[model samples]
Target: MAFNPPPKMTAMAAAAGTYKANLSALQLLMRGLYGGAYIAIGAALCTVCSTGVAAHLGPGIGKLIGGAVFPVGLIAIVITGVELFTGDCMLVPLAAMMKKINFGMVLKNWICVYIGNLIGSIWYAYLMAVGPLVSGHADGMLAVNAFGITAINIAVAKTLTYKAVGAAGMWSCFMKAIGCNFLVNIAILLAICADNVVGKFFGIWFPIMAFVSSGFEHCVANMYFLPAGIFLNHWHPETTARIGGLLQHFGGLTWGDMWLWNELPATIGNIFGGFFFIGAMYYFFYRKEVPKG
Candidate 1:
């Protein structure tokens, strides 16, 4: 069979969760780092592909292009068995609900994975800022290429624009993040349902495409996106100064602003979206149906 029934899938998720919890601290962090870098690869691809696309096509079509390509990272993670914090937000908790792991274990995994993801994301962001984004120019001579400018626009939109909106912006970011992980966890579940490689590919692809096209916020991806932009601001101030449109709103983006406005709120929202909306809901609904060990 190419698919598992709902109850069977639920049981598999619990088992997978248990396995994740059993991993040693070093194992979890290492896998988490891989996962983060993988996600950054997809994000960077999206930025590069979508740059200047809106002018050629339309805004909606450009977003669709980005969304279509963004799932490569998650597909790689799922197939290769790396740890992603957003995915863990659901998986570890589902294990706890199944009585296969404890809350402490869940917290430990979350902390380790989150830290690993941050380190990995920032490392990749530096590579991107200095490498492809700037075309390997020296620090002082760095000129923001089109892709680099696009990255700055993204970071500024995610952070400063939200900061400008005050409480409403924070709430908006939270809601978008919630929507993002909700679809992401569903994609994970769908991947679990498939029994073959092709099945898994399609299962992971569509939901991810939808979330990105819908303009939802994803914290793991943003860890790279925001820092890449911040690095550009510092390395290519002249390039930023030349841009006008939305760049005017982004006076000076600080690391603190990145965390305060976007990443922190997005992380909180992702936890709820994955843990409660998908993980807990699916666990409870299928609990009675899950087979006994």
Candidate 2:
């Protein structure tokens, strides 16, 4: 029966937020690097584990499998105390609401952590592109496998599908991004509520699994997913060409498309969802009852 009450959890979150907001840029960046890499680990695992699952089990179950594995990253981030932009969107803002930090501090944490996350995500993406996603032949050539195809398809679906519909596409991506952070911060809160490892693990797992299974957009995950696809395409054009009309129909996966279609909007939406929906609302509901310092 051990659990923090809602007000206590809010206060604890605010305190954690304050601590995170005050971290040195180096600390924030380094932790964020770990955060990003950990998330990429989950993302990569999800991609590999769920490969061909849909063909066998149906898309719904494939998504569930992928979602099931994706929480490992967030669990690592929360348990190890690393900065993740999506989580920070809620945490730092909560601290600000409690008057424990300023907006400047919140912005600082977000910016540094975001850059670190992008760096870590892309770095892992590079590893995946050159490593497991491709196999080298005796003749010094490389080709992508089923997992590689899945990565490319993911990248295309995240970006080109949005671009194809123009404004409406962007809107859909934005809405999905909002849902993503809403669940993400909720996972963070649930993690805070738990008093032990097993409690925290399951607490973190469900919401994260739900978000990924629901096909929500997450900016940090996309940092890895999109670039992994881009790197794969660059490493193996023949494989990229195999994706066929999706490539041509959506104008292919370029850096511009990666940012314009997914990353940019997702980031903005994550901030809105995490901050307004979770951080602000929680503060509003629990502020007066939070024990005074």
Candidate 3:
């Protein structure tokens, strides 16, 4: 497969940004829903596949397994033409910088897509809570399974651990969020560079795997991950007793904790990371070379 050169790829990225800028609020919202659901599918897969992997293989291997499967969501989004908020953080801003769209349009896109993504993520979380995360017993009651426990553990780690250390913890989460989008935009750039399906697949895969394996924070993914755990914990309050660490220390996951601890900081950091770190930097490097419309 052929690869586009850097200058050409830069143009392609900007062009993509312009295309997204023209989408209607309803279109953006509907696509955003799909984007959120697709990412949840990947997150659920990672949770289920990585169960007990740390015990048998190792923690590193466990992370690798989760990371490897997690890219499927982004892959689906890219192939199916859905709107993902994290990706739009770069794409929409890049178009504005290129003068193809205005700041107002960019803000509109972000607002609609962000809301859509949150709704979609929560919707998937409900499905998991009622489905694979639970098991039916002889009594016809469903109980949280090992995967559900893992989800709760992940949620607590993402939220309470950061809450534990105060400002320092928030700063840590912010920095991780920055790192995550830096790689995420890089994956998008690579996808734009590739001319074929296989090329785009591999292009998008590695950086995403690296981000997930390295434990960087992603706002949209957390939208799903945090809620799924919260749902499980709410339905199976006994699971709270099962979790020994930050979950118990914090009195379990709450919506406020989810936003205050991880989501809010993560969203801000993601904007900076994707907008400035990737979008602005790329525009600065390629502005003169970008083709005039």
* TM-score head-to-head 1 vs 2, winner: 2
Each candidate's TM vs. the true structure? Answer: 0.96, 0.98, 0.98
- Candidate 2 TM-score versus the reference: 0.98
Candidate 1 per-residue lDDT, tens place, 105-206, comes to: 999899888888888888899999988897645655657788998898899889988898899999999999999999999999999999998999999999
Residues 1-293 of candidate 3: C-alpha lDDT, one tens digit per residue: 89998878888888898999899999999999989999999899989998999999999999999999999999999988899999999988998998888999999999999999999999999999899999999998999999988888889889999999999999999999999999999999999999999999999999999999999999999999999999999888888778777787777789999999999999999999999999999999988987666
TM-score of 1: 0.96
Name model 3 segments beyond 4 Å from true. Answer: none
| Clash counts for all predictions | 0, 0, 0
TM-score of 3: 0.98
For model 3, the run of ten residues with the poorest summed lDDT: 243-252
Write candidate 2's Cα lDDT for 41-141 as tens digits: 99999899899999999999999999999999999988887889999999899999899999999999999999999999999999999899888788888
Which runs of model 1 end up more than 4 angstroms from their true locations? 136-140, 245-250
How well does candidate 3 score on lDDT at residue 115? 94
Q: For model 1, give the 10-residue run with minimal summed lDDT.
A: 240-249
